[model samples]
Target: MNRRAFATLDRPYKNKTTLDLLNSLAVMKFSKIKPLVSAFPTLINMNNNAVNCLIKKTLFPVFCGGETIKQTIPTMRKFRESNIKTVLALAIEADVDELERKGTDAVSYTRKMVDDLKVCIDGASKFSDNFMAVKFTALVPPGLLKRWSFNLKKLQDHFELVSTDGLLSRSNVSLVQDAFPNLDASIFDKCDELSFSDITAAVSIFGPNAHQLILNDPLSVDADDIETFQLLLNEIKDICEYAQQKKVNLIMDAEHDYFTPAIDDIIIGLARKYPQGFIYQTYQMYLKTGFERMKRDLLRLEKEGVAMGVKLVRGAYMDHERHYAKMNGLASPINETLKQTNDQYNAAVEYLIANNVPLFIASHNEDSIAKACKLIGPNSNVRFGQLMGMQDSITFKLAQGGYNVYKYVPYGPVPVVMQYLYRRAQENREMMNRLDKDKRYILTELKTRSLFK
Candidate 1:
């Protein structure tokens, strides 16, 4: 396809000041000056009046929705006018420390999270027929997840020597004879009956660092943990049901590899329960297992007669995943190279399109977007997605082509959302390099418009 065919930079600016600030930010990002890029988060946190004003004027408009949902409406309206939809994301990080400082009560934390999400859902329902993306971590305590991870790793290591025969059952649990000879075989027998409560109880006995003890056997569920898990499930189900009633789709955002397995399980359960494509899950294609997992999910959904709704991303947690894997002496779950990720991503797109599944092609890569456009010719069940600030050319181009496109517009208090902004900066280096090309496209469009004068 010709470059200009997908380069229609119709509304590059809401006004001249907005245009100038964007161009400046683009230049800074394109230069890849380390200190300049890295200083943004620090500046945001400095709480200086001048710095905050500048960020609100320049950075906020381009990327974020606004401090509140009401403030985001105008931006959402602008996209709607261009035949683009908005994916409303409340740009709040689930920082465990921040949560504790705000409140020590678990019930209070849960209530706060639900209330925040309700605002997002209500705001999104007003304009977009697209999904509202939420992080599961926001609803649950991060400490609990850490404890689960620690316990699971310990349990998996203990079973590493035992011959499981690749089966995860009570029979396999009994095979742990030599590993924990003094431990009651009854514990192995009760594996099937263990609940989250049992797990928490074991945590008290075995302590957090008890690597030697089987702790709460991974073979069984813990009652307390199950209660917490149920609470999370109930909260998400409430959100999904609310979204369904409001005609807004809900997507569970993928996070770090440490938490993703549980997140995936929860998303799958939600998908099964509310199957008409109302609830969706995100799959980050940068992971080596992403493609195969997508295939498996599709097959499972097909068997269950549920329409699978998915948003495919190139992933945002690359650095964190690599670092964590190295630190923990675990095999890295990320794809070895970008090319491998792209290949898997395209393959996933093809598979989803072929199977007539509801798909959100959430990418900014030109080639991937083009491939999806070709595969989705005359199909409305598929939509294109890009983040709010980056890839305007791709987003606008796809939308102008009479295709469904959505921008993930994140909105929250500026101080609270800086982490989200920092993440966008870190992840979009390649896309930022394309800013010069976008600027030229904008210049060309400006000249064309000037000719009419």
Candidate 2:
């Protein structure tokens, strides 16, 4: 790939005033300072008044779409003009206090979240066929998921024993009986009837040492936990239905490993139910098992006649995952080296293209992007994606080259998205360095324009 082909400073900055260009350069230069401020709470609060003013003028415009969907339309239009698309993401973190207050009676909370998500979908759909990305954790309470995951782990252990015994019965009645001896038999009858053959087939698909039968749509949680699980599913189903009705694609954001299995189960279930590529699950390539998981999921969906949609990403949550693994004394699930991650990521791109799976190749790395561009055919259902503020060069160049490209534009209240901003800064150091390079290009452009005038 020609590095010069990816140079996009002038084209991306065409709408910007000289001050806007300089301010963006200043923000990138000062990106390191925000992490320092975040580390010291006292310092952050003490200088909030001034810092907020500075952030609004500099950081906010570059990164976020806007505080609300209506406010984001103009930015979306700008991307359209550049022959790029927008995946408007609502960056609201889950409110723990509100979820706790709703407690077991989450009807009101569920309704509110669905309503809010519908607004985001409706607003985003106006700009493109691809719509908003919603964090499942934002819609469902993390505590409820934690409780469900805890119980599901026990159920998985029991199923593992059953799988070891090699029983191939008409229904999972035997597995359920052994797994939940305490629960009513009626509940087992009520659970989705998966035969022993189905279990064996799924296990074969997932390969050895995979979590056993935890992918059961309504996982075998306790009676009380069932209500919360159903409620969460109902919210997801509602949002997905609305998205489908609007002819918009919904991308479910992946969370930590603890929550990923359940999230995957929900997304796969939705994919099977809705079919026709309405929903996509994100795969984080940094995980050691990510390629295997993606391969298994694609095969499973293919067998079920469900059209699979995917967004491939280099995993976030690396620091948190490593810390959690070390604290628990479990083997870290992530790739041990950057090279391993890059290799797996590129391989995943190959697999998706070869399998003819619809994919969003979400990366800022030029090498990866160029590799994907080479593999993608004229009729390939693939698109390049970069985050809103960063990677302007890569995003614009891909568009200029006639490849489908998108910006993951996040929008929410500033205070609520502070963590989002910090993560963006931390995760995109290479892009930050590129921004330093971009500053020189911008300066050169400014000088040329001045001389021409």
lDDT of each: 0.69, 0.70
Deviation from truth (RMSD, Å), model 2: 5.7
Q: List where candidate 1 sits over 4 angstroms from the true fold.
A: 1-31, 44-50, 95-104, 149-223, 449-453
**242 in model 2: Cα distance from truth in Å?**
1.7
lDDT (10s digit) by residue, model 2, range 242-310: 988887888888777767765666677778778989688999999987897788778877877889789
Model 1 C-alpha lDDT per residue in residues 1-453, reported as the tens digit of each score: 222334343554333344644454554454376776768668767877787677677667778978999999888887888778999999765643444322235545766788888888888888758668898778766555544555444444555555344234544544444544434444435555333223223333223312234344554334455455545555666777888888888878888766664565557667767888777788999998788767766676675687768889999978778998999898999999889999999999998888888888899788888777766655358888888877777777777667788999999877777777777767655555566556655565555556322
Per-candidate TM-score against the hidden true structure: 0.80, 0.82
TM-score of 1: 0.80
Write down the RMSD of all candidates, one decimal each: 6.3, 5.7
* Model 1 residue 15 distance off true place after TM-score fit, in angstroms: 11
